[model samples]
Structure formats: structure tokens, C-alpha cells
Target: MPTAAGHRAITTASMLTAEGGLELRPRLSEIPAHVGVIMDGNGRWAASRGLPRIEGHRRGLEALRETVRAAIDFGLDYLTVYSFSMENWNRPIEEVTDLMGLLKRFIRNDLKDLHKAGVKVRVIGARDNLKPDIRALLVEAEDMTRANTGLTLIVAFNYGSRQEIAAAARALAEDVLAGRVKASDIDETLLAQRLDTAGLPDPDLIIRTSGEQRLSNFLMWQAAYSEFVFLPMHWPDFDRRAFASALHVFSERERRFGGVTARGQADKVKS
Candidate 1:
């Protein structure tokens, strides 16, 4: 990442406004290294509009496509999305099938384009019960885009935070039982290494759409200090403006990571 003062002037193709007018934008500073999104409100959006739920999901895909491009243009290094979860299986079978179809379509249609744009796709989740074809598609996407060096998109499918932690603990327990590692040697870093997102940096910001304020069991361990931005718009309605607004707010915040700033310490003393 370059210094905050170093914004290269590029073509205005990606800086178009909602009205399609070109605009010169300042270079972004204080960009978060990793961002996580909880995509919500597809079903509610469809219900309110008296449309099939699938329509909202389809539109959400478009939003995701635009967001990926925006993240690239905005200089974000890593983006993680809560695509699907283990709890999602409890929904209607028809909806689950539709969701799975959408997932398949997204990979088949978008993988080539993403690879061309230098994006690497990584799926983090349990693969035990997925259909063989779904598993194959995921593996294909990862293998195909593994060598790219641009933005890393992490898709959390069939994932649950508690389950993720338990799996890591289980793996560590097995190692200890086998005498490969001692129980006393375990620590935060060692536990993190046993998780699926071992090599990836923790999220700097987490945004949830549809006005949700809770984490909904996503990235429990990885989001310890991540700043959160909850939006009233549905997932399908999230656009570049929304993304930029979140980043702007993030830039103004002072992240002390459980400590106080010099100003804060001075105020404390004065008080």
C-alpha cells in the first residue's frame, strides 16, 4: 500500500457518478486492509416489493459484482462476504436450491472475469455435506484464481463461527493427544493458526446491510476489534456510494485497540 498522500491519477471510467457524469476523486487514505460484509435483507426486500425472493438475490449478485470492482478501485486488499451459512439449510428446500443454483451460476459466469482482473477467490467453510458438483466448483475456482495477486475475496459458505472455533480446538486437541504439541504451548496465535483463515489478516471493518446491528455469528474470532458499520439499505441496494461512506467513517475513527490516545490520557488527567 502506498502512503495516504500518494493517489495516482487514473482514468475516470470507475469514478462515474450515479447520473453517469465523470468526476475527479481524491485518493483515499486510511484504507482498511480487510473488510467483511454481512449481506442481509434479500427476502425482506422481495417481500416488501411483492416479488419472488429470488429476484432480490439476483439483484444482490449485481451489487456484489459492482462492489468487487469498487473494492479494486478503492484500493481494498481483502474483502470477505457472508454468502451462506449452516443455518441457511433450515430454510425452505426450494429457496436453498435456488441459492445453490445462484452460487453455481456466479462461479461459472464470473470466475473468468475475476481471474482476468487479478482477483483470487478463496472459500472458507466446511465441505463435508456439499454436493459433489458444488465442492468441485469451489475447488476449481480456488485453483484457477490461486495465483492472482490482487484483491482476495473470501466467501464464507456453509459456515458457522462456533463451528469454526470448535473445529480449530478439535484439531489442536488431536495434535496434543498425539504428543505433536503440548497443551501448555497453546495460545491465541497458535489457535488462530488452526483456523481456516489462518494466513489472512483480521478484518479492519465489518459492514452489515438491512440495518442489522449484530454479527449474526460471522467471523467470531477474527472480528475482535473490527469497526462496524450497519446500513439500512438491503444487500441489493448497497452501491459504491454506500461503500465510500463506510470507508470515510472508518477513516475518522480512532482505533486504539483497547488503549487510549495521548489526548484521551491528557483529558483523563485533567478530569
Candidate 2:
């Protein structure tokens, strides 16, 4: 394992010091093709510190910026993060508005750095629900990174697995009705084509921060067989060393596609 110099303070489950200096290490050359993260525990993290929930959210956004750099350094091909969920709208109006404002600021301020690094930015979710300017900014970011060749960044904004599946089903039904595609041909591949992550590969690793155990309506269909890591650290608390540990864990796992069952070391006994 590489020495955790620049990344330890960021990703480790350590308490923040009086000084807000956190070091982030550059990513290794070997990164997963797809990595999914559920950015949870922001409000809880704030509550623990006896601070307002919005403060935690503000910190979470800063962590997200660090995450982008970690993803790039890791040499990951795709990085998907759970930023806002369909259920997040249930929070207080002030909080929701604050998050939207932060999102806008992120676009205006962060896009330049991302564009320079060749990272593509895309948001997955319904646009009708967000504010007009927020929606516009999202579109602008996507357009700016449409031609980027580095890691593809997917931000799940106002996204839900159930809603995505319903939309895909509706599109397939329409195609079948119009005689464009055969009803019998509506297999996994056909359904995938209609999903928000149509062209992207299925996520290989799904990490849920804040020690959450459930999927929480994340990429249910796409993460059918993804390796899962639930980190105890909150979203804002998660940093580069934490990401490195996750990668290290991922490297040690032996995946089984239902064909062979791993026993000890070299044994792949048929189930």
C-alpha cells in the first residue's frame, strides 16, 4: 500500500483540528471503471457538532470538490455521486434553497477547474422540479463538458431509482406502441438504453458514506452486482485517504458473476 501522506487527513475518520488544513493525495493510476458514492450524513454531521444543518451541507459541497480531484487522480473512468435526492425536497424550504444556491455557485466557480482537467459534468434527474436558473446552470455545465475525455462525472440531482425505472418503462411502452421496437425485445439491454445512465457502464463499486447500510434508492438496476462499502465517516468528513482505503478494499475482493463461488484462495467451487 502507498503511504497515506496527502490523503490521510481527508479520508480518514479523524476529527477536524483547529486549523482547517486537510491534505488530499493525487489518485493512483489504477482506478475502477465506475465508482458510485452516496453522499449521506451531512445534516447528522452538523447535528453532532452542534451546528446548523445548513453548515454541514455547505461543508459537504466543499468535500465534493475534493472528491473530483480524488477521482481524477485515481484514474477512474466514471464517477457518480448522490448529491440531491427526490426525498431531499422534504427538508425545510430554507435548506433546500440553500442547497440550490450552493449548486449554482459550484457550477459558476468549479466548472472552470473541471473543464481544464478534462472532466465531463452531467446531472441525472428531472429538470422541471429545480429552479429555472439552477436548471440553466446544470445545462451549461453539461454542455461545457460534453466533449471532455477524462473521467465522466455523473451527479445525481433530484434522482431516484424508482422514478428512473418508471421513466424507462414508459419510454419502452411508447416505443412498443409506435411499432418502433418489438415488445418481446424489451430485455435488460433495451431497458438500459432508456435509463439515465444509458451509455455509461454499470457501477463497479458503490460507497455509501455516514455508515448507511441501505441503498437508499440509488442505482438499483445498474448496481445489481456492484461491490458495496459503507463508510462510517459522514459526507463532508470523507476525503482522499478514505477513498484510497475503499480502493484498497476493492482490490482485494474477488468478484463472482454467479458462475463460481470463491472458497479460500484459489478454489472456485461451482455452486
Residues 148-262 of candidate 1 have per-residue lDDT tens digits of 9999999999999999999999999999999999999999999999888999989888999999899988999999988899999999998887887777666656666677876
RMSD of each: 4.1, 5.9
- Backbone clashes under 3 angstroms, per model: 0, 4
Which segments of candidate 1 are over 4 A away from where they belong? 1-26, 266-271
lDDT of 2 by residue, 85-105 (tens): 999899999998898888888
On lDDT, the candidate that comes out on top is 1
User: Which 10-residue span in candidate 1 carries the lowest summed lDDT?
Assistant: 1-10
Q: Candidate 2 regions off by >4 Å?
A: 1-29, 261-271
- Range of the 10 consecutive residues with the lowest summed lDDT in candidate 2: 2-11
Models 1 onward score TM values of 0.91, 0.87
Q: How close is candidate 1 to the true structure, as a TM-score?
A: 0.91
